[model samples]
Target: MKLVVRVKLLPTPLQAAALEATLHACNGAATWAAQVAFERDARRPLGLRKHAYAEIRERWGLGAQAAQHAIKKACDAYTTLKANLRGGRYGRPGTKRHTRALSKPVVFRPEAAQPYDDRMLSWQHQTRTVSIWTTAGRLKGVVFTGQAEQLAVLAEYRQGESDLVRQGGEWFLIATCELPENTLNAHPVGFVGVDLGIVNIAVTSDGECHSGRRINRQRENDRALRSKLQKKGTKSAKRRAKKRASKEARRNKDINHKISKRIVAEAERTGRGIALEELTGIRERARLSKPQRTTLHSWPFAQLGSFIAYKAKKAGVPVVHVNPAYTSQECSQCHHTARSNRPSQARFACKVCGFVEHADHNSSHNISRRGWMAWVCGARSTAPALMLVA
Candidate 1:
């Protein structure tokens, strides 16, 4: 498994200025190389590197590895464009009626950064410093600080590449580390269903619901503040609003991390696999009103699902995505499928057998059953469907 650990870097004023200059020069070279490659229709990395390396090295005052890194960045941009074209994500470049504009050159902000390979960067564990090759020359003794746990990981499992990033007037070093993959001795005994919703972020088959009430309240407050700031129409107000938005996002992400940790821990403790709904394109299918659309779009269902899957993998607990159709309406007790079974958002009442439960809880139960059938049958097509038996 690969993990990235970010540490705060404390560079001297001079070293900070040099680092800033190096970032700008490297990104500038990348922008220029991308423009040249786009104009000449060159997509191959080798050809692009060969074309731009010498110019970048001399003009940008970058070391050899730094110059190659710039070329690689440009080539990667073209590679993304080519993949988009092939996948029909966008129209071909240089066409009159293209889906996206390709005329404008790619520009990199000061924060837009590049990676340092082993040849261009070295870390000192004893000194707690890193030395990096830059346009102004090599800068050594750049002190970095992090939690003891992260420093320990860095000392033991640090990989070859690290990215230098500047954000909110702070410089950080993000180091990649290699870790052993988790292996479990026991197979999954059962499946735990997780139902994701706007009201409750997630509801498990074991009757645990992580409420989204606080998240929703916070988002609404932030949205109101943003609207008020936008109406004021001042530069400082706008900047403050943007910062507030960033803070809100960070808070939401932290909440998701916690919720996912709990869900994965439950599955791991019980030796059960996790079952989640395959909810692709659910927003489009819902055909919600404008306000509802905004609310639904802001929901972090996808991020929460990804967190659960990755954490589960690291804990050696399996995760499966099941078809979402009729999961909410299907009765967990009687297996009767009817839209009327879910009379309201929170309540689930079966029409025929009169089994009642929380709507999300019933859905989770149905989802767990579907996951178990998929696991046992080994094929979705052959999986037996829930039916009412007389």
Candidate 2:
């Protein structure tokens, strides 16, 4: 499995200036190359390189590798844009969003992250320093710091390219680490099913609830602060709003990490697999009021599930993604299916057998049983069509 490790780069003022210049030059070249490709309707990397390679090298004072990388980056952006168009991510054809996206050539920000190959960047794990190529020259001996575990991972498994990023007045390098996957547990005693939701965040078959009430409060506060700052309409206010947005994202990722670690640890210790729900197409299918929609859109259910899956994989714990349909509406105790089984958002009751339980907890139990069945039946573990046949 591939993991990413981020470490802070403590560059000297001169080195930082050189990095800034390099980013500005590379992104400028990329923007120019993309514009040329869009005008000529050229989508192939080879074609773009043929047209813009030497130009970028000479005009932007980039070396051979850097110029090629810049052009390749522009081509990759177009590829992504083309995929988005085909996938209806910008809306269907003739829609305002889709038409607007087609109206402009792609542009790169001056400080956007840039990928560096081993030729351009080298790390000194023992000394906690890096040597990176910059516009001025090769910037060497730039000190870096990260969590102890992350540093260890970098030393042992770091591989391939790394991205140099400048965010919120700091420099960071996101290094790719190809860690070995643990031996998978083929025979598990049971499964720990996790139900992900906006209110509760996560509920396990063991009746453990990881509430999102506090995180929801924090999100609301963040939204309010950003709205107020944006309304103030000052440069400093806008800057603060950006900072808050980044901070909120960091918090979301941190919380997901903690939750996933604990869940995977518990499953590994108990010799049980993990079960998650197939929540694809949820945003498109769900209908809610404005406030509810805001909460749903902001909730990090997918991130939590991904965190759980990768951590479980690292721990040799099997993971199954079960069909989410009717999990909340079906009664776990009596196998009765009805919309009325969920009397409220948080409560479940089975009318046929006079059974009741917390809604999320009941859903988790149903999911766990389904996971066991799927595993025994040799069905695709992550298939979304593993139907519940209660």
Candidate 3:
């Protein structure tokens, strides 16, 4: 039940530079550690090399603890993957052999970064402030907090609403503490089906659809701006370039938040479990025109899934993701499967059984039905029957 929330960090120009430098140092350390392990493993596998860890430490000039940590991480990754390969789900090798970069990513669990304070810092936007070590840099009174509105973003973090992290020029945080265990209302038990598409963002089996038109327009505009900026290639162009980049990133996040909230709210209102497509071969199977590929890539489907899952968990409702193999082609009413069932992108007319419905709506219904079957057959492990919403 962990949740994270991310807000923009507005620091003075000098402070920004210092933070950037700190990140680079972290990445550099990780890279050197990874190289040390790679060189050792290449010489001899762990079975033959008794001095593998020692060699990496001496060769890479890394401290004892850092060398040990890197090798341990590498070995754990390899072993986990090797096990997965031996137990093939569909008789295909599952060994993920590709190694990630040294600075793959850093995760802070209870406390993200170092220098943890025994006592938690209270949130006081007007009076509370930030300071850095003097020896690290001869700087004082760096303005870490901007306007009241900017600092307002931290209120959720301070109130124990989410966790936070800063990485790769962005911030990500989740609030895990105050998630409500169940909704406080009385409604009949049911299920809601969700259909994911490339055009319209999502269509619910409950006769509600969320449009992705605005997001699509924004991406198109970004592409056109990129073309223009590439041609201009001046200082002003560069400034404008950064501005658009930041704006678009924020825009995409906001859209995802809104769409997720809407879906959660709809499910809560109906006192129903959520049924979503467990998209397996989505990327390879997506049939979009070349011009639409970029926009489709940025749709944030995984984030949407996470948002729905966490929200449902908080509300004491169940969220189910079903195999999406035939949700698009199967008839919700009669279970008919044929290309003729969907005469057009927007229409669904079953051939075996004369059932007519909207394409997305039919897909959503099928998704919900599949989830119901899973529930009846006790196929899902983590999911149990949802108690009454009240």
* Winning model by lDDT: 2
Worst 10-residue lDDT window for candidate 2 reads: 381-390
Q: What is the lDDT of residue 21 in candidate 3?
A: 53
**Worst 10-residue stretch by lDDT in candidate 3?**
381-390
lDDT of 1 by residue, 263-378 (tens): 88998898888888887988866755787677788867777777777677667777778888888889999999998888888999999999999999999999989888777766
Error of 1 at 68 (Å): 0.8
Name the better of 1 and 2 by TM-score. Answer: 2
Q: What's the count of clashing pairs in each model shown?
A: 0, 0, 13
Sorted on lDDT, highest at the top, how do the candidates line up? 2, 1, 3
Tens-digit lDDT track of model 3 for 1-390:
433333334556766665445433333443443444455543223532354556654654444443444444445444554465466632454334322222233221322332212122223345434443211342344344343533453443233322223654553222222223465222326568888887778888888888767767767889899779979999999889888887777676666667767887887877777778886677887777887677668667766676666657766667777888878889988897987788988899999889998898999999888877776665441232221110
- Rate residue 333 of model 2 by lDDT: 83
- lDDT to native, each model: 0.80, 0.86, 0.58
- lDDT tens digits, residues 267-305, model 2? 999999988887798888776778878888887788787
Against the correct fold, how does model 2 do in TM-score? Answer: 0.91
Best by TM-score, which number? 2
Off by over 4 Å in 3: 7-188, 224-246, 287-295, 379-390
